[model samples]
Target: MNTAINSRIPVALTIAGSDSGGGAGIQADLRTFAFHCVHGTSAITCVTAQNTLGVRRVDAMPMEAVVAQIQAVVEDIGVQAAKTGMLLNQEIIFAVAQQVEALQINNLVVDPVMVSRTGAQLIDDDAVKTLCHTLIPKAVIITPNRYEAQILSGLQINSLEDMQAAAEIIHKTLRTKAVLVKGGGMQGDLRGVDIWFDGDKLEVLTTKQVETKNTHGTGCTLSAAIAANLAKGKDLWQAVQQAKEYVTTALTYALDIGEGQGPVGHFFPLWGLGTGDWELGKKQGSREQGAG
Candidate 1:
């Protein structure tokens, strides 16, 4: 084997919308990337006026602007891996798919942000169809929560078997290398389980669910962590497993900053475990959560 490598820092790109709330979308992606010690780049698709409560308004960037941002980032910076979240509409999705194809980006992670954990539709029907047709096939893996998986695979996910079936369908239909059907929205014991299928064996990755209302940008964080790990040369399964652990640890330090649902503590390493101050962090987190 030829062993030739340079000393360049790994870079991860995020193609997504801007969340003013700073809990989800591009903000969360960049934070997760930073936590992984990877360089993070971004191309904003839409700008949303949002908060912990809900989205107030959204202004999508023009197609040319979105494309230009991606082109600029890729031409000079050269992404090692990329993850996409919250492509606002059909046009944006099509544009992103075109850029990914044109640049021949191999390690692509697609987080299909079509629906919320509460079963609320976050994207339009046209965008969903475009994503299923164009973007997903180019991805190395697609991460879809239970709600999005149900919409994409046309299955009602009520159990682990249902999640496995949905992962199979998503893999076969979307032509992606792998599918991670997240079970966060599932009721009871299935809550923190996720089904992973790579057109071969299926693996159920499970974690103890942290009981917290401050799970605002969990999906974004997890997918971004995967992309960051991929950029750092981790294998697919290892990347996913490590990413899950990071998310769980972050949830263990979830912050209560806003009036509504708060965000997971992305800098837990600086404040909690890394500094040997988890007890103090937990106490502070509780006070902040109660204050909001």
Candidate 2:
């Protein structure tokens, strides 16, 4: 139990890149932590000039700087849970794996951000190889979207069985404790069904797919939410379930700020107008109780 003496706040660390648009990467991770009421720390791996449209330029951080940031946070603050995203190259991936191994960060979630929806490879082959050999093995759980899972497992996922097969291959090949093959990119009814495999048990987690284009930071948000829930002492399955719920709600109230794909509403509970009857009832109750 990582209980800070004075604060006792659960802490989650995100080792990822920075999205200048504040829609994905470290920005999304921090927003998710805040939503879960957890303390968030970050060690940025790269800096990206990106928006809802697309990534324009990406500058990978030096291995030394990335490692130093991780060490600085871990040595003092001490993370209860940690996650990795957007490791742009082999050097960063290798350095991060070494540090995670050295510090023995147990509750680790790996989000393999390798490819875009258009089937374009985002990182180099060497980086993917490094992630396969090093980073994935250290993760307690790995969250890979359909494309990433396909890349990792070398299995095309066209159906539920295919998704499960891919998850199994990823688990066996990468040696992670658990694997979630997200099905959001799938077409038709298969869209929101995510497949989870944890060696012994295979589970299908499902949610209603929101009919919105404002889903830019969803992957980062979901992984960070899982890490946050883990930091809060939830079991592995419970953390994934909670994270799924959180993401569903965020999608339901997704933002419409950008011209392209906008960000999910991370602060929806704080900002969104409640459902009509519920809001009215709450107001009435508050008035009766002489509050608000």
lDDT tens per residue, model 2, 119-197:
7889989899999999999998999888999999999889999999999999998999999999888889998789999
Runs in model 2 lying further than 4 Å from the true structure: 1-6, 272-292
Give the worst 10-residue stretch by lDDT in candidate 1.
1-10
Predicted structure 2, TM vs. truth? 0.91
Clashes of 1: 0
Which residue segments of model 1 deviate by more than 4 Å? 1-7, 272-278, 283-292
lDDT score of residue 173 within candidate 1: 90
Top candidate when judged by TM-score against the true structure: 1
